[model samples]
Target: MSDSSFSGFVQSFKKLAVDTLSIREGSDPEATIEGIKKDMTFKGHAAWILIFSILIASIGLNSNSPAVIIGAMLISPLMGPILGIGTAIGIHDVDMMRRALKNIAIAVVISLVTSTLYFSISPITIEQSEILARTKPTILDVFVAMFGGFSGIIAGSRKEKSNVIPGVAIATALMPPLCTAGFGLATGTYKFFFGAFYLFFINSVFITLSTYIVVKYLRFPIKKFIDRSKYRRYRSLLIIFLTIIVMPSGVIFMNMIQETRFKIAVDNFINDNTVFQGSELLTQKIVYTDTLSTIDLYYMGKNIDENKIIFLNEMLARYGLNAKAGEYFPLTKKTLVRIHQEDGSGADIDKKFAEYSNDLHSKLLRDIYTKNDEVIRDKDLKIKLLEKRIYNLNASKKDPYPVQQLNKELKFQYPEVEKYAITSIQLQEFEGDSLKVIKHPVLLVKLSDTVTDEQRPEYLGKIEKWIRIRLNDPKLKVYKF
Candidate 1:
C-alpha cells in the first residue's frame, strides 16, 4: 500500500465514475444553435400545429379523456419555444432569450385563442375531471416541471435525441393549462382562467429555469457579451424571475396540504363517530383561511342530539382542526350540529318539508300495515271456526241429528220410506282457470214395500224437495234404492 498504488486506485475509481456518469456536449455548437433557432422560429407550420394541438387538447379536457390529452401532448409544438427559452438562459445568450420569449408569447396567444374559439362553439360547457385536475398547481406539479425541464435539456443536448423529449412534454403537461384557461374564458368563469394560466406559467418558467441551471452546471461556453454589466444584469433578472415564479406556488402548496389534512381528519371523524345509528354523511365542506376555519357536514337518517354533537366537536378540537369559542347549545346563535341541520337559510325550508313528507309517508304505510294485519287475523278466526264445525258434522255423518229429523218427518207423513242415509259428495268444479273440489250433501233412500214406478217417483220427489228446503240448496237430487 504505497502512495503511488493508492493514488492509482483512486484515479482509477474516479475514471470509472466519470465514464459511467458523464454527459458530453458532442453535437457541434453551431449545429446545436441552428437546430434550436429553427425550433424557436414562429413559422406558419409551427403556428398551425400549435393551433390544431390546442383544439385537440381543449376537446380532450372538455371530455375528460386522458388518452386524448396524451395524444395532444405528443403532437404539440408548444415545447419547442419553451425549451428554446431555457437553452438561451442556460448559455447566457440574451438575443436568443429574446427570440425565444417572442416565439413563446406567440405560441401562448395562439393556443389561448384557438382553445377559446373551439370552446365557444363546441356546446360542451360542463367542466370535466381532466380540466379540473389542471386548475390547481401543487408542489408536486413544481417538481414535475423541474424534472421534465432537466430531462428535456439533457435529451436535447445529446447528439442523438431519444423519445425522452415527448415523454417530458407529456409529463410536464404544457398544453392542458392553456386550453383549460380557454374553457374558463368561454364559460365566463375567471377562477378557472386564472388558476389554469397560473399553472401553465409555472410549468414554463420552471422548465426554463431548470435548463439554465443545467447549462450553467455543464459549463457550456458562455456567449461572452462585450459588457460584463449586461451579463450580471441578465443573471440577476433570471434569479428574480425564478423567485417571483416560485413564491406564490409555495404558498399555494402549503394551503393545499393544509386543506388535504383537514379533509382527511374530517372524514375520519365523521366515519369513526356513530353520531346516529344508520346515519349517512352525504357531503363535507371546509372553508380554511387565516381568520375562519369551519367544517360543514350534511347528513340524512337518524339525527344526533346536541350533547352528542358537542362530544363530536370535542373530537374535532382533539385533531387541532377546530376551535370553539363557546359552549354549543341548540336554538342559540352559534351551535354545532352533528346531524341533519340547517343554518336558517331558505334552502333548509325545502329540506325540512321533504323530511316531513317522508315521515308522513312512512307513518301512513305503518298504519295501513296494521289495519291489514287486523283484517287478516279476523278472517283467519272465522275460517278456523267454520273448519271445526265442518269437522264435527263430518264425524257423525252416518246418523246425525239432521238424518234423524228427516226420518221422523218421513215416518210421520206417509210411512212409505224404510231407511235413509246422508253422505257428502266431493266433485271437482272448474272455476275460471282453476279446478276446485267442492263438498255437497247427498240423500239416499230405500222403500220397504214394492211400489210401481209412478208411485216411487211421487215419494222421491216429495222427499227430495223437503231435503232441498232443509239443506237450503234447491239443486239437491234424490236417489231411490
Candidate 2:
C-alpha cells in the first residue's frame, strides 16, 4: 500500500473511534442534561430494569454465585444515569448533572434496601469467601474502578457494533457492591455497609467523570441544553473540580497505611523467631479469612528440647499469642531406632531385624510427609495384607488378656468397645486395670498429632509390645496400626 493510502486509513479509524465515543460539549450543558432526564422513561422502563437487575444481584450475593452476579451487572440500567451525570459535569450541564445524581442516589438506596430486606429474611447464615472478599477495598480496587469506568464509557458511546458494554459491566462490578450492601443489612454490620457504599461511591464518581470527558471530547453542543441557569453551572464546576482533586489521593493514602501495618507485623514475626538453630522455619501464614484474626507458624527440621520450646513460647506470649504450638518427631529422621522383620517366621527373625536396624541413620531433615511431593497412601496389596493381619489374629475369651482404658480422643476404624460400653469415659485419660479375656486379640496404639499413615508402624510396634507384656500372653497375636 502507498504511504498516502495508509495515512488516510489511519485518519479514518481515528475519526470513527472518536465519533463513536465522544459526546460533544455544548454551551447550555444544563439544558442538555435536563433534556436527557425528560427523555428517560424512568417510571415505566428504566425503573423496572433497575429493580430486576438489583434483584438478580441480591440473589447472587446471597448465594455467592459469580455467574449470577455477572448476569445482573450486564442487565443493570443504573450505569446510564451515572454516565449521564459524568457527561453533564464534563460539559458543565448542571441540570442534567443534578438529575443524574438524584437518579443514582435513588438507585443506590433502592438496591441497598431491597437487598438488605431479602438477606434479613433468608435462612442462609453461611458467609461465603466471595462475599467476604468483596467487602474490603484497596488501592487496586480504586484503580480497577477508574480504568473500568473509562473503558465502559468508551465502549458504550461507540456507534459501530461491538460487545464493549458487557466488558464495561464486568470491569465496573456494579452488582457486587450493592449485594455487599445487602449483606451488611442482613448481618447488621455497619463496617460492611460503610465499605460497600464507599466502593459504590468510587465507581459512580469515576464512571461519571470518564463519561463527562468522553462527551466533552465529542463536542456535544453545550448551548443546546435545556436548563440554562448560572447557579447550576457553578455547582457543576465545583463538584467536577472536587472529584478530580480529592478522592484519588484519599484512597491512595488509606491503602498505603494499611499495607504498611501488614508489613510491620510480618517483619516483626520473622525477626523475633530467627533464634532456633536446629529447626527450619517452614511458613508463617497470616490469613485474614474470618472476621476473627489468627496466625499459623509451621516449623520443620529437628526438634529442640522442651526448654527451648518453653522459651519460644514465652517470647510469643509477649506478642499476646497464647495458642499452644504442636510438635512432631519422625523416627527415621529424629530417632536412632529402626527394625525390619522378615515375613517367614521359620527364618532367623531377630538376626534379620538387627541387621536391617543397624543400617539406620538419623539426619536433621524435614519429615517426608510434610513436603508437598510426598504420596503416602498405601497400595492395594499393603491394604489387603493389613486386612489379613487383623483376620489372622485369633485369640478367644479363654486366653488371658488385659483390660485397658481407651482414650476418648482417638477414633477407631473398627467399632470401639469404649463407644458401646464407656459412655462417660474421660478424654485422653486411661486407667490401668486387671487382665481380662477378649473375643479376639486387639492392638493398642498411641498417635501423635502430626504422624502420617506411613509413620504408624514404628509407633504401633512399641504399643503392641507393651500390650503383649500387659496381657501376659506371648502367643497372643495382633496387628498394630
Candidate 3:
C-alpha cells in the first residue's frame, strides 16, 4: 500500500474510534448538574425511600436472597449524593460539596439505624452467604464501581435518558454493604462491621472518582476558578486519598488469586493420587491459610502405608505446596497432608463417609436450584416426574450386602465355622388391634464337627456381636447348627 493511502486509512480509523467512544456529543452538563443537586437532598420521599430500601436490603441479606437484594438496589437513592459529591468536586463548587456530604452523612446514619433495627428484631440471625460476600472488597469490585460510575454519569448527562443508571446502581451494589454493616453491628461482630463498611467506602470513593474523571474530561464549566497552585494541591490530596483507599483491595485481590491457584493445584494433586491399590479415597478436606494449609485425606478398605505417605508429601513440592525451611511463602507456610484410614472398627469411617456424601448431595442440589431456578420453574411437572422416576429406580435396587466377603470374614475369625447364610425376615405382631410387620436380619452358621456343644453358645454370642457391628444393624439374630 502507498504511504498516502495508509495515512488516509489511519485517519479514517481514528475518526471512527473517536465517534464511537465520544460521550461529549449529546451531553447536557448544565441540566445534569441541576438534576444532581435536586436529588442530593435527603428528605420526604427520598428519605422514606432510603429507609424502605434499607429494610428491603436487610431482609434480603437476612434471607440470602439475591433477587430481593437486587430489587432493593433498584429503589435505592444512595447513589444520588455520591454523584453530587463527584460533580461538585469537578466544578469546584464548595457549597454543593458541603450539601452533598451532609445529605450523604444523613443517608448513611438513617440506613445504618434502620437496618440495625430490622436485623435486631429479625428472627433469622445467621450470617447468610449474601451478607458475608459484601464484607470483602477486592480489586474486581473497584473496577465494577468505576465502570458503573462512568456509565451512570454518561447516561445522566444524555438528553435522551436510558436504564443505564438503574443498571449501574445494581452493579455498584452500594446498598447491600451498608445493610451488611448494620447486621455486623447488630450481631456485635466487629470484623464484619469494619470489613463491610470498608467495602462501602471503597465503592463510594471509586464511583466519585470515576464521575469526577468523566466530568473533567467533558470540560463541564467550573462554578469557581482557582489558581493553578491551589488546583494542584487539591489534585494531590485527591490522589493520596484514592491511593490509600485502593491499596488494601489490591493486596486482597492478590491474596485471592494465590488462594485460588493453591486450591486448583490441590485439586489436581488429589485427582492424580487417588488410585491406590487396596484403599478408596472416600473424602478430602482442604484448609487454606497464609500461615499454614492442610489437606486431610480420608480412606476406607485398607490403611495407607508410610512409604506411600512419604511419596505423597514429596509430590507436594512439585505442586509448589511443600513448606520450605526459610522462605516467605505468602500463599501458605506449609501444606500438611494428614491421612485417616478406616480400621476394622467401621463406625467412625462409616459416619464420616455418610456426612461427606450428604454434604456433597446438598451442595449439588443448592447449585442446581440457584443456577437453574427459571428453567426449573418452567418445567416443574417434568422435574417432579423425573424425581419420582429416580426415587422408584433407587427403591427397586437390591440392598448392597457383600455376603461372600462376610462369609469369608466369619470363617477367618472363627476357625471351626465352615459356612454362613444371612437373610432378611419379617416378623408379624399385633399392637392395639393393629398388625405391624418388622424386618430384621438373621444370620445362620454351620460349624465343623470338632466344635463341641458346650462352645456353641459362646461362639454364637461372639459371632452375633461381630455380624451386628459389621452390618451396622442392631436387630440381627444369629443361629448355630
Provide the overall lDDT of each model, using Cα atoms, as 2-decimal numbers. Answer: 0.73, 0.57, 0.84
Give lDDT tens digits, candidate 1, residues 205-272.
Answer: 88987877777666666785457798688779978987887787888887777666655665576677
Q: Estimate the TM-score for candidate 2.
A: 0.49
lDDT digits (tens) for residues 416-477 of candidate 2: 22222211112343357655443345553435546567765665565456545755645444
Best by lDDT: 3
TM-score result, candidate 3: 0.71
Best of the candidates, TM-score:
3
Ranking by TM-score, best first? 3, 1, 2
Give the worst 10-residue stretch by lDDT in candidate 3. 365-374
Estimate the TM-score of every prediction.
0.64, 0.49, 0.71
User: What ranges in model 3 sit over 4 Å off?
Assistant: 305-307, 323-330, 345-481
What is the per-residue lDDT of model 3 for residues 351-378, given as tens digits with 9 covering 90 to 100? 5455656564444333333444234323
Q: How many pairs of residues collide in each model?
A: 0, 23, 0
Q: Residue 175 error for model 3, in Å?
A: 0.4
Check candidate 1 and list the clashing pairs. Answer: none
Runs in model 1 with CA error above 4 Å? 1-10, 25-27, 92-94, 219-221, 224-230, 278-290, 323-338, 341-481
